[model samples]
Target: MNPIRDIVILCNNRMAFPAIQTLHSLGRLHTIGLPAENEDVKAFCSVFAAKAGVNLIVMEKLKLNIHLQEIVRINTLKCVFTMTFPWKIPEEIIEKNPNVFYNFHYGLLPEMRGADPVFESIRKQKHESGISVHAIEKEIDKGKIILKKTLPLRTDFTHGMLCTHLSYLASYILPELFTLLHLNDKGVQQDETLAQYYKKPTITDVSIKWEHQNSKSIQALVNACNPWNKGAYTQWNGINIRVLEVSQIQTATEQAKTPGTVLEINENNGLIIQCYDNTLLRINTVYTDEGFMSGHKLLAFGLKNGEQFASI
Candidate 1:
C-alpha cells in the first residue's frame, strides 16, 4: 500500500538537489534519471547516486521516454518526480499511470505557467511568488495541484535569489505532498480561466524598451535579467551594453527629452536617464566592452551628456 514504491527522479538542475535529498531520507528513492546532454547536472547526479547508493540512468534527450520504459520494465509499480527537467515528457510515459508522476514547478501554476518563471515573476514585479507541486499531465503546468506555498516578492530579489528560495521551499513541502499521495489523493484541477502559459523569454523580452517602459517597469526588467542575461540591453555608440541595475532618483515634470536620453552624467548621482513617464532612472551598474563597470563609466567610454541611447 506504499505509494512511494518504485520511485524515479528526473531532474536537470540544482533546484532538484534538495528534493532528491528529501526523497532519499524518506527511504522512498529508487532510480534517478538524468539528462545526458547536461554535463553539469549529469556530473552532480552521478556523484549523488554513487554516494547515496541509488540507481542512476543517463538518458538522451530524444530517447528520454525510452529510458523511462526501461525503468518501467524493471518494476511496473510507478512513482516519479520531475524538478526543472528541461524536456517535455512524451504522452506514452503518462498515458499508463499519470497520478504517480509529480513535477516540482518553480512558478505559481496556471498563472505563471511557462519557461523561466523566475525571470518572468521578477520582471513583471509580481507582488507574490511561490512553488507548486502538481501531478504531471501531458500538458505543461496544467496538472492538478497537490500543494502551493507562497511568499512576498521582495523589491531587491533577483532571478537567482528567487530561484534558490523556491528550491528550499519545494523541499519543505514534499513531505506534505507524499502524505496526500499515500492517501491516494488526486489533487484539485486548475481553473482553465486563470491559466496562462508564458513562453520562454526572447531577446526582445529582455531588451530594455526605453521608449515604452517606465522607470519601475525598466528596473523590474533589469532585476529579472540579473545573473542571467546580465541586464536589459540598449545601444550606446552602436555598441551593445547591458544595464545590469538601475534606480529611480527623481521625476521630470515634462518629457524634457526622449526616453533613453541621458539627462545627465553626474559624478555623485551617476548616469541619469529619462524614461517614458518622465521619470529619471539612475543607472548603477552596466556591462560594456570593458566588462562590468559603473554606469558613470559610460561617459568615460565616450557617451556624451544629453545623447540618446540607440534604439535596439
Candidate 2:
C-alpha cells in the first residue's frame, strides 16, 4: 500500500473544510491558511482557519516565501501537495523534488472553465455540469484532469448550494485521486482549444434586462441570481423590487404587449408581464431590502395592467 505523507491545501473557504477532512481521512497531514490584506482573501482564510483549527497559518504574499524557505530549511521532503495557495510557488520545489500539487475547480475543463460556472450554467440551461480536480498552473483553472465527476443542474439550485454540492463531490473524489497520485499516475493533458472561459459577472450584468428577454431566459436569470445577488432588475413604481422568483405563465392572449408591460395582476395567481416573442413572465415573489412580499402588493402600488417597465 502506498503511504501518503505531506499535503498542502489551497482553495476557497467553501471547499476548505471538506478538503481538510478528506485529506486527513486519507492519512495526509495538512495545514489551513491565514488572513491576508485582500479583504475577500482574508475573510476566506479567517473562516477557513476557524473551521480547520490551530494548524492554520496566516501569511501575506511575501511571508509565504519565507514560510516555504523554513519548510524547506527544516523538512527533508522536497515535494508538497497544495490545493489553492495564491502564491506562484517555485517549480524547483515541485519538479526537482517530485512534489505533487493539485487543485479543484468548480467547472469541467473544455467547458465552463472560469470563475462563475454555476451562473453561466444556469444562463445556458445546461442539463449537466461538473466538478474537476486538476494540476494547477500559472494560468487559472487550466490543467490535466486528476478526477472529474458530472452533476445535474437542478432547477432549485442557488450559487451557494451549487458550490456546496460541488465541494462535496470534490471531497468524495479526493481519496481516490490521492490513491492514483501515490501510484505514480499523473493525469493526462487537456485540449486547450476546447476550453471555454467566463469572466466574473459585474453589477451591471446582474441587472435584469426585460427587453429582448423571453420567459425561459428570465427564469434562468432569476435562478442564477437567487440566494445571492438578485440579478438584472428594474423599477416597479419606484419600488426597488429584487426579483426572487419567476415562472412561465400560460395565457391565451396573443396580443403583443410591450416587453416589461404588466399584463395582469391576479391576487390568486401572480403578476404576469409581457416578454419578447409574445411570451409571458409570471413573477412569483419580489424582494426588498426589508423583506420579500407577495406579488399582489406590487399590483396594489398602481402599476396597473398595460403599464410598461421599459428602461429609462
Candidate 3:
C-alpha cells in the first residue's frame, strides 16, 4: 500500500472548486499552483491549501519552470491538471515531468475550444454545453480526452450561471477520470475537422449592435453578458448602458419604425424596444451610472417613449 499523494492542480478561477475539493477529499491532491499575478485567486487558494494541509506554490512567469522542477523533485505525482491557466507550459518542462498532465476545459473540445468558452457557448446559443477533461498536448486544448459530459444549456442561463454549473459538472467527471486512469486508458484523439476555436474576447466583442441584431440574438447577447460584462453594451441618448436582463416579445407592436426605438414601458414587462426585422425585445434590467435598476425605473431617469437607443 504505497500511500504518498500524487496529483497537482494549476488553477486560476474559483470555478475549479468542486474538482479541487474532490481531489483533496480523495486524498490524492499533493500540491496546488496558482498564479501570483492574481491577488484574490492567490489569496483564496492559499487559505484552501493551508486548511487542506497541502503544498501551495505561487507561480510567477519567470519562476514557473523552477517551481515545476521543485514539484517533480519533492512529490510522488501522477499528473498535473490545469483549469483556466492563462499561459502555456513549456514543452521541455512537460517532457521532463515524472507523469502526465491534463487540461480541464469548460466547453466541448474540437468544436468549442480556446478562451472564455463559457461565455462563447451561451453567446453562440449552443443546444448543449459542458466540460472536457483531456491529456495536455503540444497544441493547447487539442488534447486526448479522458472524459466529456454535458448538460442541457438552457436559453436563459447567464454566463455566470453556466460557468458555475459547469464547475459542478466537472466534480462528477473527476471520479470517472480516476477510474479511467486506474485502467491506464490512453484517451482518444480529437478530430480536427470538427474544431472551431474562439480567441479571447476584447472589449469590442461584447458590444450590442442594436440596429443589426434581431430580438432573439439580442436577448442571447444580453444573457451572455449578465454578471459578466454587466450586460451587452449599448447606448441611450449617447450615454453608455449595460443591459442585464431581457426577453424576446412574441409579437412586436404592429406599428414599426427604425430599430432601437423605445416603443413602450410597463410595470411587469419593463421596457419594450424595437429590434431589427421588426422584432421586439423587453428590457428587464440594466446597469448605468445611476446604478442597477429594473428597466421601468429608467422612466424616472428621464426615459420616454419614442426616444431612440443609439445604434451601438
Candidate 4:
C-alpha cells in the first residue's frame, strides 16, 4: 500500500471547501487559511476552521516559508497545494521542493494564463475551457501542467455560473491529483509559443462598444461580465446603464440603422437596438444605480425610439 502523504493546502475561496473537506477526511491534510477580502471566502474559511478533526492554520502572508518551516519542524511535510490563492509562493520554496508544490488553475494553461480566464474565454466565445493542475513555479500560472480536463463552454454561461462550475470541477479533480502527486509524478512543461496572458478585466474592458462590435459579440460581453463585475455598461440619457442580459435577433430586412439606435420597443419584444453590422440585439435586463430593472421598465424611464446609447 502507498504510504499516506502529508499535504498542506493554502487557499481562501469557497471553491476550495469541498477539496478541503475531502483532504481532511483522508486524515493527512493540513490547511492554511489566508485572510480573505471577499466575505464569502472568509465565511468558508471560518466554517472550515470550526469543523472537528481538521488541522487548520490561519496566516496573513502568502510567501509560506515561515508557515512551512513551522510545519516541517513539527511534522513531516510531503507536498503543498493551492486553489484560487490570490498571491504567489516565493521562488526559494519552489526551487527547494521542485515538483511538490501544485496549483489548480481555472484556465487551460499556455492559452489563458492569468486572472479571470473563464470570463476571458466567455468574452472571446471559445468553444472549450477547462481546469489545469500544474507544478507551481516562480512565475504566475507559467507552471508545467500535470493534468488538464476540458468542459464545453456554453453560450449562456455567465461569469458567476462559469466560476461555480469550475469550482465543482476542481473539487472533483482534487483526489485524483493527490494520488498522482503522492506517486511523484512530474508534470509536462508548457509551450512558451502558445502562451497567452490575460489580466483582470477592468470596467473599461467590460464596457460595450456598440459601434465597433456586432450583436453576437455584444451579447457575449454581457454574458461574460454578469454576476461578477457589473455587466457590460453603457449610458442612456446620461444615466449609467448596466446591461445584465441580452440576446441577438436575426433580421431579414436590410434596413440600415445606426449602431446603438433604439430600433424597436414593444410589449412583446421589450427593447431592441441595432448593432454595428445592422443586426439587432434585444436587451433583456438592465441595472441602474437604483436597482435591477427589465427592458420594459427602461421605456417607462423616458427611453424612446430612435434615441442612441452613449458611446465610450
Candidate 1: tens digits of C-alpha lDDT, residues 209-290? 8889988898899999997888888998888999998887665745468889998886787998988878779999999877
Give per-residue CA lDDT, model 2, range 62-141, as digits (tens): 67666655555434232344543456666565453443556666777768877677788887778877777777665667
Tell me the spans in candidate 2 whose CA falls farther than 4 Å from its real position: 1-5, 37-54, 61-64, 67-99, 237-239
Task: Tell me the spans in candidate 4 whose CA falls farther than 4 Å from its real position.
Answer: 1-5, 62-65, 71-74
Candidate 3 vs. true structure, TM-score: 0.95
lDDT of 1: 0.84
Candidate 4 lDDT by residue in tens digits, 1-312? 643547777787666767777767666576555654567776676676677445566665653668756655446577777888877787876776676678888889889988888889999999888899998887899887888989899998898888788888877887787777768778889999999999988877899998898998998999999977668899888889999999889983378778999987877878989898878889989888888978767877789889999766
Of 2 and 3, which scores higher on TM-score? 3
lDDT of each: 0.84, 0.68, 0.85, 0.80
**What is the per-residue lDDT of model 3 for residues 127-146, given as tens digits with 9 covering 90 to 100?**
89988888887798997888
Q: Which stretch of 10 consecutive residues in model 2 shows the poorest summed lDDT?
A: 74-83
- Of 2 and 4, which scores higher on lDDT? 4
Clash count list over all predictions? 0, 8, 1, 0
- Which window of ten consecutive residues has the lowest lDDT sum in model 1? 1-10
Q: The CA-based lDDT of model 2 is what? A: 0.68
Q: Which candidate, 1 or 2, would have the higher TM-score against the true structure?
A: 1
Q: Which stretches of candidate 1 lie over 4 Å from their true place?
A: 1-6, 74-78, 250-255
TM-score, cand. 1: 0.92
Question: What's the distance in Å from true for residue 186, model 3?
Answer: 1.8
Q: lDDT score, residue 127, model 4?
A: 88
